[model samples]
Target: MQFIDLKTQYARIEPELKVRIQAVLEHGQFILGPEVQELEARLAEFVGVRHCIGMSSGTDALLAAMMALEIGRGDEVITTPFTFIATAETIALLGARPVFVDIDPVTYNLDPAKIEAAITGRTRAILPVSLYGQCADMDAINAIAARHRLPVIEDAAQSFGASYRGRRSCALSRIGCTSFFPAKPLGAYGDAGACFTDDDALAQALREIRNHGQDRRYHHLRLGLNARLDTLQAAILLAKMEIFPEEVESRARIGARYTELFQARGALGTDVGGAPVLTPYVHPHNLSVYAQYTLQVEDREAVAAKLGEQGIPTAVHYPIPVSEQPVFHGGLLGADYPVSAAVARRVLSLPMHPYLDEATQERIVAAVAKAAGL
Candidate 1:
């Protein structure tokens, strides 16, 4: 089976998608066209934010947010090391440091309790990644940021429809960034993303930053990158948005069902090679869009091989911690992040998508159970 099954999703939205693309082609306003503004407005409204700046990619979205905040040379940005490279790459690109923090073993998110100790005079921002479609402890993170008088940027690349304490992911922080990479819950045909905020000044700065720091046509204000989202991607996203709300609901439901199926076969706390198979944990009052329903299992390689033999595709969201990356040269590895290190070894992401069928899910779960020797 296809890992994400985007073909089915495309088939469902084909008619509307074609129409949207046709309209964009006819308008001939390819860059930052009317559809882009409409998309920005709709996305902002959905996130309950005052402004949404469409960007070239999720990486650029983070870069723009950092530029708007003036997080630059010699500054340090606190974040977890157990996420995608872009989460830390953006900080380093701005000539800043990415301070690594350990993750919560259960949720696999940056543990808020460990954040305060990482802050120092050089700390400029707290970038928390909402890994696996679930938001980090934003309430605690925000409170800590407020106490330190620092801005919080939610690297919401994996979470667009997720919610924490009744608020959306992009609206939970001072600046929020999300990706529209084809695999994301809401994605464009090509690379695209957005930065969201309620702060007018930051919003305006981000807008300028996305267009070579332009104040108006042909006017450059500050050193900025050309990070604007193309109109074709905007139109495609607008079309995808038509069914995004329902798709979000379907994903959550499918996630819950996966948990139930696993539990029935003795997943959690079930002995597999003298170790328990740990399922993902959703914090109370938090609603995840369930981008990747991952599990912590022993003998991950063996289990993955078996799953592959059964025609079930599995992936590891992150196999290496950013701290251990070659470029970091183990500079951030002085302190042991046992949880991040351990999770990296055991985590396996099963096929997950909003349109996943129950029968297919059952087959996939059964294969995993057999592989785990349950």
Candidate 2:
């Protein structure tokens, strides 16, 4: 089965998608077109934010957010190491050091307890990633940032549709960013992203930062990049939005079913070599979109191989922590991130999508159970 059944999703929205794309083609305003503005407005409304600045890619969105906050050389941004490279890469790209923090062993997100200890005089901002489609503890993180008088940027790339408490993912912090990569919960056909904020100044700054720092044509207010989201992608996303709420519900249902099936098969706490096979630990206050239904198992490679033999596809969300990446020179500035190190070796993702069916899910879980020797 496909890891993410985009083909099925496309078929469901085909007619509306065609109409939206056709309008974009007919209008011919490819860059920052009408569709882009409309999509931005809708997304902002969905997230309960004042502004949503569409970007060319999630990476650029992070970069623009940092730029808007004036993060640069000699500055430090506190963040977790157990996330996609883009989380820390953008910080480093801006000549800012990414101070690594360990993750909560249960949620595999930045451990708020460790965040305060990492802050120093040079700390410019706090960035927390919502990994595996669930939000990090934004309330705690925001409190810490408030104490430090720093901005908090929530990297909601994997959790655009998720909810923390009663608020949406992209509306929980000073600046929130999310990706529209094809595999995300609310993905577009191609690369796209957005930055959301309630601060009008930061919103305007983000909009300018994504468009060569121009407030208007030929007016360069600050240095920026050509990171505006394509009109076609916005059109496609707008069409996708029509059914996104339903898809979010499906994802939550499917995720719960996967956990329920694994537990019923006696695979929840079963030992897989050294480590026990563990399901994702979502916090009670958060509603995850379940972008990837991941598990922690010992001998991950062996487990993945066993699943593959049964014609089931599996993936590793991340095999290496950013702190251990070669570019970071092996734990940059010589800090220890034991939790990130451990999680990196055990995390494995299985097929997850809103369209996944019960029978297919049973087959996948049975494969996992057998693979784990349960």
TM-scores of all predicted structures: 0.97, 0.97
Model 1, CA-based lDDT:
0.92
| Whole-model lDDT per candidate | 0.92, 0.92
336 Cα displacement, candidate 1 (Å) = 1.6
282 in model 1: Cα distance from truth in Å? 1.0
TM-score of 1: 0.97
8-29 in candidate 1: lDDT tens per residue? 8899899999999999999899
Residue 339, candidate 2: C-alpha displacement in angstroms? 1.1
Worst 10 residues of 1 by lDDT: 268-277
- Which 10 residues in a row give candidate 2 its minimum summed lDDT? 268-277
Question: How many clashing pairs does model 1 include?
Answer: 0
For model 1 the local lDDT of residue 137 reads 90
Residue 195 lDDT (model 2): 97
